[model samples]
Target: MRPATVFLLSALIIGSLEAKPNIKNFFSKHFFKDVYGTIDANIKVGDAGKPLILTDLIQQDQIDEAQAAAEVKLDAFLGVKSYAGYLTVDEIYDSNLFFWFFPSQSNFEKDPVILWLQGGPGSPSEYGLFNENGPFFIKDNKLVLRNSSWTTSNSVLYIDQPAGTGFSFTNGGYAENQTKVGEDLYKAIYQFFQLFPNLQPNEFFIAGESYAGKYIPAAAYTILKKNPSDEIKINLKGLAIGNGLTDPKYQVMYADYLIQHGFIDPKSRDALKDFEKQVVESMNNEDWDQASNQIDVELNTINGLTGLSSLYNYLENYSDESDDGIGNLLSREDVRRAIHVGNTDYGDSAVYSYLSSDIPKSVAPLVAELLEHYRILIFNGQLDIMVAYPMTVDYLQNLDFVSAEEYKNAERRKWRYGSDVAGYIKSAGNLTEVLVRNAGHMVPADQPEWALDLINKFTKNNL
Candidate 1:
């Protein structure tokens, strides 16, 4: 997050066009510079027209919710039994978080409910909802139901977090660290269960990509901290992270990953050694902001030296990299009215700025703590260069957990999706990691069928 001024975890940078328009891109680092409109000189967010409670939004009248609601703006009252509202986290500052909920598309009512989060320390979870595995995708300027959306069998909830990103609003208040971020989400999610008592029994999950790697594990850890019978029981089941930035200490090994993939000369490894040394020093000193800055520079330096256009994925140039349409759709008066937000902006830079120092701090220990009781799924795209598969394995292998040796010596089994060898699965105890074949940073967007297969199996304890 020290890249607060340098880079963003939203999407990898893109230059010009490529041969095929297939890859997805996010806001440029410079994009948020101008996007910072007003920083709340004086405001009362509680009275700012944001919905306080939304138990009534999900009614017997609404149909084809969530994926259906966002697509058809007409009568866009609700999504497949969907609900959209804000949860006030800090009453003193009046900071609030926005969420969009979707019901299970399956006939069964006891299906699990998964909460999808997006990274950037500031990125909205809508990226996963609209682009990767949402119930609907925007095709040819139209909203169409996605064939393999995770929502088909399970309820999905997409949230705009940290009180400044997307539709979330704040008045001089924001999270300063991963623990605060997790606490804010925990309060909101706990309130969520209170509003929808019907979903209390359905197993729940926390899933996301990129910077969310930090947000998710921290949230799961918070779930454990708050689960001491203080409130409604969150039948918590598991977690899933794709190409996450969990342990920067282990993941900062760009030189090793590059050499293994033939992206850099082995001789250049000597020059890159300084970057690693500096990052380690920053981590040792506990100056997380400095470490984050050093890591950003290191990646940018390598990307420049190698002329790699898109660091997230090496398979394509800037192809289908855009969420502009989703932005436009959300801005429409009808869409805002449908979702219950009255002209709230998306991509607030303040959220990223607030979380600047939290980027480099490792959530790996949080993962280790949760490993004792939960089923953890950490999968990454094979072609992802940002958080490479090797980097993920590196940390998981060395993670301080009960099944360290067992997981280290565990065999990697072949996994399939209808005869197509989709990926490789490695598991020991409750921890499961997979290397999705032919996928880049966005695994669900590139190989959705397999992504669905992975989650369905993981939640069902079938993996």
Candidate 2:
């Protein structure tokens, strides 16, 4: 269980006497800055009692147990190094963020480093690790090697960020917006590279899904802005977002999506059209709170009638039973101790905290800014209603960037995985978008082989 003080601190920062605080309000941004200044004089160091850095907070980097439990071939672990531990972010409040690193199976020195963040703004990247593209998957009652995992050729780093996320914990106040989340992650990555210097020279990419759409661009922008010199650079190569919610206005194409898919009756579509109109009006008037609430009400109404099937994926039956099992596995005394979680509970708090904040500003501008130098891959599953593929294209088509015309006019090539048609890719210059067929919001899990191929292509700068 989390301490009462943590909630108290969070409330003080986010829940002021003001009703519906605007994200642009000045008070919140500088509240911590004023109190802590640029640096805190009373800050505490790591367990070694040395000056704080990324490596100091590392409690464990053992590959033996996790590899043995994963049942991977001995040769696989020979080149790969897995590190799991808490990296202290706030010494004054004892905020420690947890991370898991899986070096590439190919070449640690040359393989690209992919930093993977999951959606929910709170979902632990471990879900991506185990269920999506991690080195192992839980089967029967043990960890089993996942053959089509993303770690096959590239080094993957998964961190539970914004604090108070799975395995990661914080006694300090939580971040209230995407900007703050980006700053925190920027610091984490800086410390991450500092801890593992060998990865400094390798190609790196920031990739995620859903809410991470907001996170990836914001963090990438922050990294670029902060590190302008080659003396201490991030070697960032590109970015990838899969079924992401980068632009809510464009991403929420439910009315058209539902009507086209026959998920709603004509009468329901009419009602949805009315609600969407009101949402647009509110958004145009800059009443974000009203716009968000109206959209939420509309979504809930649609979901209430959609039956028990997952909103994320219409084709599959949704069951949260796996999350519980994974939680229980991670919460084990031995597991916690091995990962150096100590007494912190493994759960999701970052989601609620982020959602409770004023609606996230659109990440469109951020992505637009990133397109100047870095390659951007935007892939979406055809069946995803939670940030539909059409919505993603709508926003991308509207982006103001250097090669805008080239990207807009590019021919979409047909892509295949084995004998089946995998997806269609439209690429021009640095920006590309792919529509994965028969998949849903979690594309990697739904189409592992295709997802791997797409990622490998993007990382190699071939797409």
| Among all candidates shown, the one with the greatest TM-score | 1
TM-score of each: 0.85, 0.82
Per residue, candidate 1 scores C-alpha lDDT tens digits across 1-463 of 3332222221122121122122222123321111112222122233233443342333332333422433323443324456677777777777788898888889436999999988776777777787899888766656777889998888998998878877888888888988888888998888777666678888999998888889899889999988986658888989999888899888878887787777766555555765577678779999776666566656665666566667777877743334555765666565666677765655557877777677778888899989998999999999888788998899998899988899999999999888799999999988999999999888998899999999999989998
At residue 319, give the lDDT of candidate 2. Answer: 50
Regions more than 4 Å wrong, model 1: 1-80, 319-322
After superposition of all CA atoms, the RMSD between model 1 and the true structure is 8.5
Best by lDDT: 1
Lowest summed lDDT over 10 consecutive residues: which window, candidate 2? 31-40
lDDT of 2: 0.69
lDDT of 1 at 97: 88
